[model samples]
Target: MRDNAFWIILQRLRTPLIVIVVTYAIAILGMVLIPGLDDKGNVYHLSFFDAFYFISYTASTIGFGETPYDFTYPQRLWVVVCIYLTAIGWFYTISAVISIISDKTLKKEMIKGRFVRQVQNFKSDFIIVLGYNRVNSEIIKRIRKANIDVVLVDHNADIINLFQLEESSMGVPVMVEDALLTSTLKDAGVNSPYCNAVISHFYKEEKNLRITILIRFLNPKVKVITRATLHDTIIAISDTDIAKVENPFEIFAKRFEIALTAPHILILENWIYKNADLADKASYLPEGRYIICGYGRLGKLIKEKLDKHGMDYIIIDENNVGTDEMIKNETFICANADDRDVLLKAGIESAVVLVAGTQNDIDNMSLFITAKKLNPDLYVISRVNTMKEISIFEKSDINWLFMIEKILINKTSLQISQPLKHSFLKRVLYKDEEWGTSLVNLLKAQLGDNPQLLHLTINEEKAFAIYHVLKANKPIGLNILLKSLANWQNYHKAIPLFLKRNGDEFLLPSNELLEIGDEILFACDAESREEIELIASNIYDLHYVQTGEEKRNWLLSKVISLL
Candidate 1:
């Protein structure tokens, strides 16, 4: 598809076709005024000016004017021929006009040409968005909000053009071409001192990884943010030229993290959509001595959050990158997270959390096991793709594991709770399909096959608290549990909803406090907890304390009283 050249010529011909029509329009009206056609076969004499007028009039042939002359048979034949030619040409011109106005081809081709030409005019200080999607648009908007110049790229030319036109006022240039192509990449100004890192696609994690690698090869100094669909891509792109969004698997972890830490950020859009405002809180930092084992997409986001909060952390990956730049506070250990020595070297014992969010599924599992071995207490948070992997990890002693399948399931089910036509959720969730095919919504709809009802809340410990319902359990308890939250929360601040329940019945949502079956995802601020507790009725005593010796034991002990 990339090599196809057939359409290029057709695209270039649009301008010439327009010129032909404009010239023909002027000539058509005059042709009909000539004294040419006679009643018989012989020719009727007419002046050159009259001939021209007649031809022009004939060409325009609106039937608005009287005949200029009675013509012989041959002259009449000539007039008929001229009328036919004029009418056919006018229709042809109309068809061409419609094609130009309606078809995407001409516009896209022109935009691409303009983008290519605009590349040479580019100076430094530009950001590159290497895929097209709502996420990309949001990312661009964020970058632009910061007043940074960005050049957007994607396979879809029309989308890029739309961005260009919409952002024309902003003066951001967009290039409609593949980010992987060297020529196109060059047009993106990847190496110019002004060029920042390249942003990868949201869903096309694999492609993002490849593009980042290419970008790195093109210009190692340029910072690149890549994406990977699974955990292993993190490991693969660890030392490559880009940071990771951490694909679908890690995305679930990040989303769940946002839910636990900042549910307000998670809410809205009928599902969890990443908003810049909450991104900082959602990042994994704040408490010092944290370790991000894989600095891919998820890790990058986490890293940024940490930075924004002025927290300390280290990045560990097989590929050595940005090690020299990190220095004391921001350490980069070029080794596997699975290594016991590496874990210890990264202060695993003292580290608050270990994000095992590599793009590879197997790597995440292995990383979790190895991390567990090194620091049994480390909050080894990881991501998984398949539903089957959930039980294995859950039973494997991982206290803070977030599975993508369940998240996708939870989100999708929430969206399609009712039938397609009868669903308010579907209307909101699929309003524009603008978020792209959210796997969360799709998996939820598929619950009829393997029904599971899961909800989430936060607890005092700050570690995610979860409960599940198997097929054996009745669905009625969920709503009752939510209703009785006040009963459960007299002793606890965080309320846990059914974090993950495996059953066919739909779960009830409550404005109550924590309940017995509640899985609480904690928020960072007391205010967030206070807000959550307002609706929660029955809250049970689930203790949450900082690790080892508390920083301010007495201060934390009086959390509820202080509230």
Candidate 2:
């Protein structure tokens, strides 16, 4: 209630406050000028305040009445110059006043500034995100990993307002406004030399177009990016020469399909972020009876990786579940995943891993309890639909990974505190192209600004090394390829950390020396991208990454002998 009242008061104060400040500045200038104007041979004819009032009337161009002082030729000339400048200044000030009056956002933000103290000293190469969402915020943290500054802007100030009150960070700044407005954008330093802009849809299509139009008018030179929802809209947005524009829903579709068909990918991504070294090692050698509850798309992929690696796991499904060959060849439990007795008969007590991957939150939750009771030492992993449920799973001693909604809570919180990041990099990173390109932009800015972020294609896996581009004016690198890890996804994190060519055989990165054209897949934030790229490309000729080929050969032989 107090916050609401505070915001209301702020909204009520914005226009009047601006008017008072401008009026006072003009009044002070008028007094100083009028006193100088009435100086006639050391005998002042009019008091400075009186002359000041007369000029105020003149600037308003009120008909000459009650003149404070008689004007000589020099004094009249000064009045003429004052008339033009003061008139122009008045028009500009009034126009600005009108802009503020028509906008309610000015006050909402004034209330926020009281708490978050937005823009607590901005720096170069900052990302300014125009809309707040999960993917957008994830982009902020990914960029922040490179140690760059971030800021967020939104018309719904309550979200950011609440965020500021909770987290008292000095670097992240949140502002409330439609960034399209010049006053708000300028406040955010949109036209400043050091800033970049990322403009996302404001919960509607028209707003995206409206914001785009407004940004162009306010700053034609500023780099603006947007994510188009309609695939048809992609061409139109791109035609505008926007720094970057994508069909957001297209990426959402891809992500949906990935989860629906190949959930291991997300699982791989999670694992990569958590364990950097897991990329170089094999997912095999661990022996256990893994229990998979849901035989849905996610469950199927988990089964495939388990089978490919020669590890044994039990598949449990209700009536008519396709253990087709499974009922004959492999150990299987045919019953509900949550039925306590079904899991008990399946030897849940001895299971090493239990995956509660069903879509129904209740079912997944129920399975969690049964699995926990069966095997206290069992590693439980579940996929959640919302962040709120994360708290529920938090106590279950289970590793939690969510679907698309997963990135929201944390990303939303991060962007709320970092308004400076509403611009270029944040938008580019989330407005997707593909995984490889996404990985490249995750790299940091190097010695200069306006560096190239890749839009790439990789046909085969081979040697990766440094190369020169941009007509030799710029040098570039590819850093980390992050994977999601959790549940049975421990298999999908990464194939190998880095790969390079050694004579005729492709080898893993080694400590000896780097060679040109050697490729590496590293998982990192922005800062390490270039250095890793140079190392992979052998730009500096440092053989830091060793090829794991020799070890893989021995490991492969052992696997062959086992088979």
The lDDT of each candidate is 0.53, 0.52
CA deviation > 4 Å runs, candidate 2: 1-142, 151-155, 165-289, 310-336, 344-352, 360-362, 375-379, 387-395, 399-563
> Tell me, what's the RMSD of every candidate?
20.4, 17.4
Model 1, span 375-399: residue lDDT tens? 6767767766555566677677665
Per-residue lDDT for 433 in model 2?
32
Model 2 Cα lDDT, one tens digit per residue, 77-126:
66677677667767766776676656656556455555243453565666
Alpha-carbon deviation at 5 in model 2, angstroms: 24
Candidate 2 lDDT score at position 111: 53
RMSD of 2: 17.4
